[model samples]
Target: MPTITLSEATFAKVKACAEPLVDDADSVIARVFDYYAMHHAMYFNGRLGIAKPNPIRLPIGSRELTHTRLLTATIDGRELHRPDWNSLTREMHELARKRLGSFEAVRKVTSANLRQGRFEENGYRYLPEVDFSIQGCDANNSAESSLRLAKAMSISLHLTFEWRERDDASHPGQAGMMGWDPTSRDAGLMADGSSRSWHDATKQAIERIARDRPRREFTLAELEALELGRVVKETGSKGATPEATLRRVCQELRDEGYLDFLDNDGTYRLR
Candidate 1:
């Protein structure tokens, strides 16, 4: 964790809030932050105190977001009108640049490596106006990027993502094609929320490849052939666009340092 300096009065106040036997300074701070995450707070008698949650807020459930689209984001109660992932990424990077006092400082952290400074290699595009490199225009990627930046800058954010609800007969009791748990850090939630079936199918195929392949290298065709039936059974949907999903999965895995894309012909190998 990064070191932060606190005044003697503030430190004493924080110590007073700690648990008798179990809470250390770090734990106390974390506990306070956890409480703040769930509840609204206001100034009471010149001191901050818990307040009621805002009456008007987005319908973001406890579950992680899946198959969703970016609509707007409210940061520390200030709303930003970002219609798409590209706009949101640009906005967040620009905000970070300004706060840090230089684009070079921001780049040092976000670049692929300090030595190479390969921003584009990491799916980022340089913005001349902001003097920053923003991530690719992907809803989940952009959301994750913004969340990461907020954490680093100690800023607060509440994102609103929209998705079309699935038909009752097709999905039954679910709001959309799939449900996501909001608290999960895993990309399982909200990543490919709009087309969860394809996402799941691609993951399923990848799992089979990792488990069954001897050489650990396979083409897209082999994945489709081996796991199509199982993927259908698991997701309750056929592979509508296997090629596209495969490409998406490949890129995701590559970024995660799990697989290496071998060729334009759709061959990939586990690393």
Candidate 2:
């Protein structure tokens, strides 16, 4: 995703929007919730290193709710039954309580993720990219809007801050990423946007696309081709043969189909 500038008006409207729950939420958390609803896995690398991307983490009950809505036992070719929110929430809340009780310092809690970008204590990050919503609010940087939110909400929740999202949306009061982060290459990132770091945004994008359409494998070239809707014209002097690029793409990406692409013209999309 190219950088998008949230307009001052949009910020105002967002702030003016009512809180999602009766739970204690100042403007800061409220805005965070808004963005979270839009993008569970978000990008929020802060220049000060205080901010990081944190994906949402759901209470298992919440997952069951999700399972109810998205998962049809017969669809995945699995043999089993599904339940509803009422049944799942019954136990999910208890599980969340038990899990939180096991933690020591409540201060250790963080809502943002690390995989979306560089995380620091300055650098800790979060994962799963779904249980949370992480994005750069640059609140201090967004002095103008920050003031508006503060004034409207009648609180001092931010000194210029960023919004935090997590997958555990149903568990609104829960704090922090569940277990820090997964120890895997999925935690990597690319500053140039050229490399997908298994961050929250990419995770959400992949899920949304997969849910909405036929899931398949493709490369950047192919995805780009697919997104562009087939080629009408091709450019560039055609320097070095793309063979090297294609070779590397095949080697480095998942063989599952990261490099496969669909092209009509120059336009391409992941198949």
Candidate closest to the true structure, highest TM-score = 1
For model 2, what is the error of residue 123's alpha carbon versus the real structure, in angstroms, after optimal superposition? 43
| Global lDDT scores for all candidate models | 0.50, 0.27
Which regions of candidate 2 are displaced past 4 Å? 1-188, 192-211, 215-219, 225-271
Residues 198-253 of candidate 1: C-alpha lDDT, one tens digit per residue: 43555666777775668778777777676553443333223336455456556655
Instruction: For candidate 1, give the lDDT of residue 84.
Output: 47
Candidate 1 overall Cα lDDT vs. reference?
0.50
lDDT of 2 by residue, 166-254 (tens): 35333232222211122222222323323233233233343344435454433344433332212111210123233332332233222
Candidate 1 stretches greater than 4 Å from native: 1-71, 74-87, 95-130, 133-204, 226-240
Per-model root-mean-square deviation over C-alphas: 17.3, 20.7
Candidate with top lDDT is 1
